[model samples]
Every structure is written in structure tokens, then in C-alpha cells.
Target: MQVIINGEVHDLEGQILLSELLERLDLKPGRIAIERNLEIVPKANWASTTISDGDRIEIVHFVGGG
Candidate 1:
């Protein structure tokens, strides 16, 4: 399956949950927000949200600045 992430196309072996995708990307759940197909997905729903082919995902990271 293929999904568009932050404007880039990524190919995956099969369907996976949003949380799993984050883990595969080495992202810390606490430090990021997810937008799926133009909708904001709450952190509480990540584990239950199943990502499918053609899904568009946007991961926004929180950065600490001085």
C-alpha cells in the first residue's frame, strides 16, 4: 500500500495503525501531532486509527526553542 506523508509518497507492505506508523518513523508520540487526510487526529485515537492506502498523513513535531 502507498500513502502520502507530508507531500511525499511512501510505500508500505500492508495496512497499519497510526501509532505503528509513528513508531516505524522513530517519532515520539508525545512530541508530535498528526493530521490525516486533512483532518486532525487526536492523540488518543492514534492507536485505533487504521491507516490505509492513499491516505494522506501529516506529522507536525513540537520543537523547544529558546
Candidate 2:
């Protein structure tokens, strides 16, 4: 399956949970926010949210510097 992540195309083997996707990408869930298919998916829902082919996902990482 192919999904658009942060404006780039990524090929995934099959539909997976948002949480799994994050882990596969080596992303820290606590420090990131996700927007899937133009809708903001709450962190609480990450484990249940399913990512499918042609889905659009936007991941924003939080950085503390101050």
C-alpha cells in the first residue's frame, strides 16, 4: 500500500495501525501529533486508527528548546 506522509509517498506492506506506523518509522509517539486524511487523530486513538492505501498522513514532531 502507498500512503502520502508529510507530502512524500511511502510504500507500506499493508494497512496498519497508526501506532505501528510510528514505531516502524522510529518516531516517538509522545512527541508527535498526527493528521490523517486531513483529520486530526488524537494520541489516544493512535493505537486504534488504521492507515490504509492512499491515505494522507502528516506527522508533526514537538521540540522543546526553551
Candidate 3:
């Protein structure tokens, strides 16, 4: 399946939840915001949000710095 993640196209196998994808990308769940198909996914729903083929995903991370 092909999906666009953060402006890049990626080919993934099978379906995966948003949380799983975060882990695969080595990102911290608590510090990131996920948008799937132009809709923002709530944190509480991340675990149950399943990603399908041709879905567009955008992951944004919050960085702390002064």
C-alpha cells in the first residue's frame, strides 16, 4: 500500500494503527500530533486509528528549546 507521510510517499505492508506507525518512526507519542487524510487524530484514538492504503498521514512533532 502507498501512503503519503509528511509529504513523502511510503509503501507499507498491511494495515497499521497510528500508534504503531509512530513507534516504527521512532517518534515519541506524547510529543507528536498526527493528521490522517487532512483530519487531526485525537490522542485517545491513536491506538485504535487504523491506517489504510492510499491514506495521507502527516506527523508533526513538538520540540522543546529555549
Candidate 4:
């Protein structure tokens, strides 16, 4: 599947759920926010939200600084 994440194009194989995608990216679900195709997907729904071809995703991760 070809999807655009954070403005970059990615060729990911097979059907991937939102939660699975995060795992593949080595991202902790609790530390990030995801917007898929202009919709804000709730963390609890990540497991069910599926990523399809041409989907646009925006990811924002929280960071702490001293």
C-alpha cells in the first residue's frame, strides 16, 4: 500500500491497522497522536483503525525537555 505519512510517501506492504503501523515504526502509542485522512483517531480506536492506500497520516509525538 502507498500512503503518505507526515508528508512523505511510504510503500508499506499488506493491510496494516493503525496500532500495528505504530508498532512497526517503533512508536509508543501512549506518546503520540495520529491524524488519519483529516480525522483524529482516538488512541483507544487505534487497534481498529485501518490504513489504506493513499491515506494521509500525521503523527505527533510528545517529548520532554529540561
Candidate with top TM-score is: 1
Task: Name the better of 2 and 3 by TM-score.
Answer: 2
Residue-level lDDT tens digits of model 4 in 15-54:
9999999899888767678999999999999999889999
lDDT of each: 0.92, 0.92, 0.89, 0.92
lDDT, model 2, position 14: 66
Q: Give per-residue CA lDDT, model 1, range 1-66, as digits (tens).
A: 999999999998877999999899988887688999999999999999999899999999867788
Prediction 3 TM-score vs. true:
0.87
TM-score of each: 0.89, 0.88, 0.87, 0.88
User: What is the alpha-carbon lDDT of model 2 when measured against the actual structure?
Assistant: 0.92
Cα lDDT for residue 2, candidate 3: 88
Model 2 lowest lDDT segment of ten: 25-34
lDDT of 3 by residue, 1-66 (tens): 888999999888898988898888888877678899999999999999999998999998767778
Q: Model 3: runs farther than 4 Å from truth? A: 63-66
lDDT of 2 at 42: 96
In lDDT terms, how accurate is model 3? Answer: 0.89
What residue pairs are clashing in model 2?
none
Q: List the residue pairs that clash in candidate 1.
A: none
